[model samples]
Target: MRERQPCVYILASGRHGTLYIGVTSDLLARLVQHREGLLKGFTSRYGVIRLAWFEMADTMAAAITREKQLKKWNRDWKCRLIERCNPEWDDLAISLGLPPLRTIEGTR
Candidate 1:
C-alpha cells in the first residue's frame, strides 16, 4: 500500500495571481483533482491550479496547522514564501512525481 504524507500546498492561477492554500494527506490525488477541475470551489472558480509551493509535515495535524497559518499570511508574505522555494513560480507537480499539466488555449 502507498503511504500517505501530510502536506501543506499552495495553488496559483499564475505568477502573483490568485492563491489557494490547503492541507492534504494525498498531495498527488489532491493536485490531480485541482488540475482536472474536479473539486469545484475557489480553486476551480479562480483557475488556481498550479502547484506553486508545498511543505511536507510529520502529521496531518501539523500540515493543517501550517496551512491555516499560511492562509492568514498577507499576499506579499505568501508570494515570498512561494518564491523562496520556487523562484520561477513554476508548477511543482512534475518535481513531485506528477505529470505536467498541459496549457490549453493559454490557460493552465
Candidate 2:
C-alpha cells in the first residue's frame, strides 16, 4: 500500500464563525465525515465543516505539530494564511483531487 500522507486542515462554520483545525491521514474522507455530520465533535456541533485551508506534511507527527502551531495563531494570522492560497474560501477537498461530494454543495 502507498504510504499515508498527513494533512493539516481548517474548517469554518461559514465565512467567519467557528474555526476548527485538524490533522488527518485521509483528509478527504475526514472532511466528508465532518460535512455529513457523521462525527459528533467540534465541526458538527459548531457547523464548522467548510474546508478553508490545508497543508500537506511528510508525516503525521509533522502535521500534528503544524496543526498545533496553527491552532495557536491569532485570528488575523490564520485568515492571512488562508487568503494567501485560498482567498475565496473555496473547499480544498476537491482541489486536492478527490471526488466532489454533495455535502460540500447541494447539487454536486
Candidate 3:
C-alpha cells in the first residue's frame, strides 16, 4: 500500500481567489484528483485547483478536525493562513514535482 500521511490542504483559484479546504491521507494523489476534476463539487465548479498550502497531521481524524476548523475561518483569516506559508500563493503542486495541468473546461 502507498504511504499515507494525513494532511489539511488549501486550494485556490488564483492568488486572492476562491478557496477550498480539504483533508486527505495522500496529498499527491488527492491533488491529482482535484486538478483532474475527478472528485467533482465546489472545487471543480469554481476552478479552485491551485495547491496554496498544506499542513501535516498525525492521523486522519486530526486532519479532518483541522480541515473543519479551517473551513469555519473567515475569508480574511484563511487568506492570512495561506500567505503565512505562501506569500506568492503559488501552485505548490509544481514544487511537489507534479507537472502543470493543461486546462480543460476552465480548470487547471
Candidate 4:
C-alpha cells in the first residue's frame, strides 16, 4: 500500500493450509504477479496466493534476514505467527486495494 519498500510476506492456499514465504521490495506488484500466476513455481503450483501475513522492514537486508528466519520456522510456528496478526487468515491484499480473490466451487 505504501511506496515500494522492503517487505517479508507469507502466502497461503487457505487457512492453516499450504504456506509460502517470500521477500520483495514492491509487495503490491509481487502480489499481483502471484495472483495472476505470472511468477511460476511454488506459489502458482500450490495455489498459495492469499496474503495471510506481512511485515515491512527498514531495509532490504533486514527483510531478507527475516524471510530466511521465517522459512526455517516449523509449520505450527508459522501458522501461529500468521494467526497472531491475522486470526481469520483473510487475504490482506484485498484490504490493500487489490480485488478480492474469486472462489471456485470446491477450491480453497
What's the TM-score of every candidate structure? 0.91, 0.83, 0.89, 0.96
lDDT of each residue in 5-86, candidate 1, tens digit only: 9999999998899999999999989998998899989999998999999899999999989988998999999999999989
List runs of model 2 lying over 4 Å from the truth: 1-3, 97-108
Order by lDDT, highest first: 4, 1, 3, 2
Q: The CA-based lDDT of model 1 is what?
A: 0.90
Off by over 4 Å in 3: 102-108
Model 2 per-residue lDDT tens digits across residues 19-86: 89999998878877997899997788888877888888988899999999998999999888888988
Query: Each model's C-alpha lDDT?
Result: 0.90, 0.80, 0.90, 0.94
Per residue, candidate 3 scores C-alpha lDDT tens digits across 1-108 of: 235899999999988999999998999999999988999899999988899999999888999999999999999999999999899987898988799867667744
From the highest TM-score down, the ranking of the candidates is 4, 1, 3, 2
Off by over 4 Å in 4: 106-108
Model 4, 37-70: lDDT tens per residue? 9999999999999999999999999999999999
Which pairs of residues have clashing backbones in candidate 2? none
Q: How high is the lDDT of residue 72 in model 3?
A: 92
What is the Cα-based TM-score of model 3? 0.89
Winner on TM-score (2 vs 4): 4
Q: Give the least accurate 10-residue stretch of model 2, judged by summed lDDT.
A: 99-108
* Candidate that would win on TM-score: 4
TM-score of 4: 0.96
